[model samples]
Target: MGKKLLNKPLSTRVISLNNSQIKGIKHKKKKSKKGGPIPVKELVPKSSALFFQYNTQLGPPYHILMDTNFINISLKNKLDIFKGLMDCLYAKVNCYITECVMGEIEKLGNKFRIALRIAKDPRFERITCLHKGIYADDCLVNRVQQHKCYIIATCDKDLKRRIRKIAGVPIIGVANHRFTVEGMPDAFGAPKM
Candidate 1:
């Protein structure tokens, strides 16, 4: 059993039919091949109290999944990621970092050592990824496929363009010394039918 929220008494976790938890997934590209949903006991890990705090109907306070470019570009523009995010969107942000993005920062050598420092901030939650050795861009792209409302923060031009292909995805980036958001993601985390 996991800990319950502070305001509410302990209650059974509600199960929603439309949630993105893939029970049996088999990932395959070719017609002859088949794929099944990887068994996931809980899509939102118990440790993530912030993610559990969000409700879709209120419409705001996005959960952000950051890219390495988000760090580099923000620092390059002399902005704190959180501070910049605060300047960009009206809603509060719950920030997260994937393992791959941290890995990328580490691999950048001394020139980018400052980024490694930024990644150490306790404010950002960790989004565990099953696949390793892939770039942060690929992992972030895969995340949007889950139909979750995650505002992606990055300054990579190409990556921004790539993300636009996915519907209902909001993006944040730095422009002229301030953070700017292109659109706001739907907090309900519903994929387009």
Candidate 2:
């Protein structure tokens, strides 16, 4: 056992220590060649269509991205999707459903059969998702970030909260037998409150 222990080399690296290291004090950090500390400029690119947080691209024929829960809530409220959207926004609305959201609804089994039927309606355009997994919220958030032209419709509180953080994107939800929009200016038919 003694000879076996002596045969093994030391695993720890031998680092020569100076007076600063022995005193438990770090040496002065090397400054940049520019002279002072590097200034961090975190520049977030703003969309050209955004005029001081208001999206100018929004107009008649609004494009809305629909989530599974939003469809479920709308059906539960007994509101017609087309008629309700027209009444609320006073515009021709185009509803979009993503493949992930469709997969999520389909996975919910027969309990949400009616929602599945509504999602299959010819009026709603289906958006294909190439990414893996069927997590609708991440897929929706990513799509919204890439294209700022969509107004997300979701009854889920978590989804609503996530959408609110992205500037120039609006959220539509069912309330009081109608659709209420958030993050949109008053001129765009957002709720008064």
Candidate 3:
């Protein structure tokens, strides 16, 4: 038999969690209800988490290009887009409206009166106003190009087509309680790409 290694010793490093840290960690674990650090294999499945991680790390800041029709439909539907926009503003996302579009929304009268009221609201005081000339679709296109905004939200089909043609900017349309983003045209007469 080999000689016993009775003289061997294990090294120790001291560490301790403060009361607040321990409490916070416990609280989080309780609230999450899925005990302790989840094993890598048991956390979000690899494929789904990889896509989410890519978006979190590489997605552009949300910048919504707006028009009168977007505001009108959002108001009519009582959708949360307005609130979402407000949250984006709070988070420093660029939200801009041109003077002509503002005027158009205001002129909508009963058709979009509520949206007009909301636009004048103090809660949205931080939204930026861009003063481009009236009847200047080119100017609007220029703004979209300059900012490289991720999406343009509107409700006017003709205007949506026009914008797509002029700026090549992606458009999100809201109509009759539904909203859809433009994609390349497909065989079913759908807007694709």
- Model 3: weakest 10-residue lDDT segment is 49-58
Estimated TM-score for each candidate: 0.64, 0.77, 0.48
- Which stretches of candidate 1 lie above 4 Å from their native place? 1-58, 185-193
> Model 1 clash pairs?
24-36, 24-37, 25-36, 25-37, 26-35, 26-36, 26-37, 27-35
Model 2, residue 39: what's the lDDT?
A: 68
Angstrom error at residue 33, model 2: 21
Off by over 4 Å in 3: 1-60, 83-94, 122-132, 136-138, 166-168, 183-193
**Candidate 3 lDDT, 7-61, residue by residue in tens:** 4433322225654545556434333347566544454223321232222221234
Each model's C-alpha lDDT? 0.72, 0.87, 0.53
Compared with the true structure, what per-residue lDDT tens digits does model 2 show for residues 36-139?
Answer: 97667798787887888888888879999999988999998998988888877888899999999999999999999999999999999999998999999999
Per TM-score, the best of the predicted structures is 2
State candidate 3's TM-score. 0.48
RMSD of 2: 16.1
Shift of residue 73 alpha carbon in model 3, Å: 1.8
